[model samples]
Target: MSALARNRVGQYEVASDLSFGDLSAAVAAGWRDFRAAPLYGLFFAAIFAAAGIGLSYYFYNRGELAWLIAAAAGFPLLAPFAAAGLYEVSRRRLSGDSIGWGPVLGAVKAGDGQLPVMGVIAFVIFAFWVILAHTVFGVFLGQSGLGATPLQTLLTPAGLGMLGVGSAIGGIVALFLFAITVVSLPMLIDREVDFITAIIVSVRVVQLNTFLMLSWAVIIALLAFAAMAPAFVGLLVVLPLLGHATFHLYRRAVR
Candidate 1:
């Protein structure tokens, strides 16, 4: 590409000013854009769901304690794949290319350096949240033994109250992190933007469109829950749609 063209492309900015107009338009545009590449979305979802199912099964069978420990250890291991998918979605959307598996994989392979960096960031943030959550739970239990078994402790009235309190704290932390990195991974992969810029822009997007972004986050969480309900079988359809939709969202935000 010519320098002028390159400059023009690079100059594209992720708006910090989020209004109802911007958010509504972004959602509509994302849906419309993703609908054009439905099959590619399906393929991506299938691969992700399959991987999730296999991992879940392996960990579940290993026992609860093992599963908990494995989750911490395995999250980082899976970060690269997650980062790759995020990048692929952004790349495909930006290039106006059909979401082909080949191109997506090619992008991941090409952006190998970014994959680990983004993965580390994601893993660290996730781990920190996990630790905080567990600590909250432990403190709650210590304060109000609630005279219940380990299982019951999570289900009893007092336990549930404590759980709710802990969850709220964890939720806030997660939301903040999500908002900060929502578009960062894709931006990095698609435009060769540095991680700092990507994160800063992402946080700006969230700050500008707080309500809309929160709504989007809720939708994603619900969808993810549903996907995991039927032994994670639903993820085959949910993951790709969500991934593609995210790319579409990024495109709308920055334009």
Candidate 2:
């Protein structure tokens, strides 16, 4: 079926023989496009960053410390669609369209209906991730609750163990989710395909070049972690960078 396919939606992307070199080229192209139209990227990223700020402020006031990890990790999961506008920027740049907020945002609004379906998938995964994270903490560190500050939990042996265990489990979930969305969002925008097909192709592409894709995942994780260091301000830059990069990366991953 893959061999007989015309559109690179489900099955496998027969046109692609992706490699690590593609990842490198994608990042470079992503940076070039971002520099060309920084405003588009900034506009979309700012919306997400502001939401981050709002959530942080709300949680801080309410003293919902346990929600912190989920909030931090979940934003990245939400990035695929949140950065739809940025992806549209990359699409416009590739097609030589004049970049304007009206047109770019309109393009995003006009994207595939399947985009929202993908969002539902992300929401489920995020909810599961948060629940699992809470469970890990509860099982390992509940006896001697981490207090005053969340960082204080790391001081104990059980706390350290819980962190280690939780991180590993979270990493697995993150990778699986990444595989399903890595190329799917851009593909959904670029083609007339359903979300399920896009997701299958996305997973197949990752399987075809597992090591390269895994490296891309690691790079995304590191950039995201570093970006959070500046109190979520860094996401303003990191989100768009990765968003635009993922578009170009998808191009290389499929026909």
Best-performing candidate as measured by TM-score: 2
As for candidate 1, its clashing pairs are none
Q: How close is candidate 1 to the true structure, as a TM-score?
A: 0.73
How high is each candidate's TM-score? 0.73, 0.90
| Residue 26 shift from truth in candidate 1, angstroms | 4.9
Best by lDDT: 2
- Could you give candidate 2's per-residue lDDT for residues 92-188 as a string of tens digits? 7898877788867765544456787787888899889988887887888666666766687786788789889988988999998999998888887
- Supply candidate 2's per-residue lDDT for 174: 93
Identify the runs in model 1 with alpha carbons over 4 angstroms from their true place.
1-12, 16-40, 65-83, 86-100, 109-112, 141-152
Local accuracy of candidate 1 as per-residue lDDT tens digits, 135-242: 655566656543435677669776787668765875676686677667776676677676766777777667666787888777776777677678667665556655
- Estimate the TM-score for candidate 2: 0.90
